[model samples]
Target: MDAYKLMTIAAIGFFVFALDKNQKKFPAPIILIAAGMFLAVFPYFSSMELTKEFIFHWILPALLFTSAYQFPQDQLKRKAAIIVTLGTVCIAITAVMLGFALYAAGQLLVGVSLAGAMLISSLLIPTDPVTVVSILTQGNDKHHLAETIEGESLLNDGTSVVIFSLFSGYYFGSQSLHIGTFILDFFYTALGGAIVGLLISWFVAKGIHKITFHVYQVWLTILLAYGSFYIGEALGVSGVIATVVSGLLLAKELTNKEEEEEKELRRDLKNFWGIMEPFLLSIVFVFIGIESIDFIQMDGLLFVIIGFLLSVIVRGIVLLATIKSVKPWRKSYTNGDITLVTWGGIKGTMSLALLLSITGQSGGSDDGLLSWAFMMIMLSLIVQSLTFYPLKEKLGD
Candidate 1:
């Protein structure tokens, strides 16, 4: 697609339709997906390909940094326990349960392997609430829930990526995964990434404090976002986790300096990143739809549907079990509220992004794992998002 044509379409689809309050119930990805699928029939729109390198190197870092910094530091501190458990423990357990479940169901699912099933399970661990956070923060009480919803994703995104990375190597025949080695490696990678991000971002913060020019300050943040990620990856640590940590620590540093100039700097940074994230994600989602036609196989829809069901059941069961340990979740939520949380955990961009990445690394795409993953994501987004409003209304705050 032509750049102008794509931008025009994204603007109309997003700003005009997606940003409308009435359409808040629907995710912007659905709109872009429809538009991309509609445009896919034409040859012009068919040529725009989304490469894994572009997404991981550019888009992922920016989104992680932007979201992390914007996340309130105080809320992160207040809800640390709940957030940590949900992100790490909840995701880990769900991934294990779902992975094993998928592997067991592989008799019906043609050519599916235990490794592929495990990768798919891990990839789906991250959730994207696009505009649902706005709906979640209707009042002061719900505001806490909103923060928790978004906050958990920030950390779990790293956990998800780490799990995917470990299993990806094993799936692709690049490296073998030993359980003992994997457990130790995961901790070292995650913890090392955090330390790297904190160290780099601390220096970046000092630089920001010294610099008076908002333009340079903004550019420095951009560097931090991408820099921390690339640097962490170079050191064989988790880049995703590094970027998240960099954003959080730097954001806390920036937020502490409440001077008028610093405030202006913050505004400028927000303005730049706020527009960039949606626009880039719009392009990525549209590309997902364009790419979808190739991956769609009618014969496998039943199996995919079965897989989706398994995913939901496993995630819900794991969440209900894991969340009881967190006092906030126990105190603030009933069974209905927990149902809403499970429903709201609709796999979105991160899931699809991770899914699409398979073709780039794995030779076979795990024998139609992409197709299975693509459909599973679509079902999750469409069913969960559309039903979310009804659930919200029924459950009440």
Candidate 2:
């Protein structure tokens, strides 16, 4: 909220935009994060902090809505089973497996509690598809693999958050874990959120149809995006799911409508969101970079390395299972597709937001967990994202 901080971020955004215009191959996010790191170490900006409210309440809703709105509905229908499997079942599998693994590691090496280990595992479970989607869709070639990744990422954030709440509640002794209760809670939140999103989008689409002014239509679209999220949250459901469903529903309705005004409204909405997406993404990556300094101070390099490897292994196993169990009607996927999905399970803003949410409950021993989470995020963004392009070229044949 500081003026100087705002100016610095604006400057970084402009620099990234310029690079994007001229240096076609250079990844803008990488540069933004690197710039954030530079600023984080510099005395003037070193103290700048990324708050949970700013990220979750302000930036994330827009990003999530835009990503979901842009997702191809036809492709999503084809890959829905795979996306749901990875988003829900796979997340639960990874959380439990990784939780026990981290518990063992913590017990023998790091002195972290089992409950704490589970909480950390829950935090790391959600994958951020932003970097992976960008890398995969950089060219004209549209593949099912990209759609699957994007769909899973869109849906999994809400699931992971619900799971995290369960783990956090148990860890903090606020609630006991009951399997029946967990299942009920999960379905209620996820399904309720979807319903809320659908209803809001339906109403918003109707309103937009009546609007005579293009500007008002555009603003209405934006309102639907954020409104679905906030309304869902207020009603005690998953806001992420609400926002995603709303965006997708709105997009589908607009696409199916044949009216000229509806078509014009769709075009304007797409242009508006397209412009906002990069600006918001740049800010996120830069904040990630600047916040890396805290991650460094937390310092659990050995644990983080082990945890990252464990995450990769778990994701690979899940992908293999998905490949084997895919129904006959679904499109057959190659080993390359499985490998890409496994490695492409990147963690970003959602994980950070979850981590920050529990900072108050960590009892001053969460630094190592934070470090591990941070390292995993960085590895996903840098190493996995950069390598996937070449890997795709070699294996995607």
Using all chains and alpha carbons, the TM-scores for the candidates as numbered come to: 0.93, 0.93
User: CA lDDT of 227 in candidate 2?
Assistant: 92
lDDT of each: 0.80, 0.81
Residue-wise C-alpha lDDT for candidate 2, range 252-302, written one tens digit per residue:
888888888777887888899988887787788888889888786445667
What C-alpha lDDT, on a 0 to 100 scale, does residue 12 get in candidate 1? 53
Which segments of candidate 1 are over 4 A away from where they belong? Answer: 17-19, 109-111, 326-328, 360-367
The candidate that wins on TM-score is: 2
Roughly what TM-score does model 1 have, to 2 decimal places? 0.93
- Output the lDDT of residue 368, model 1: 73
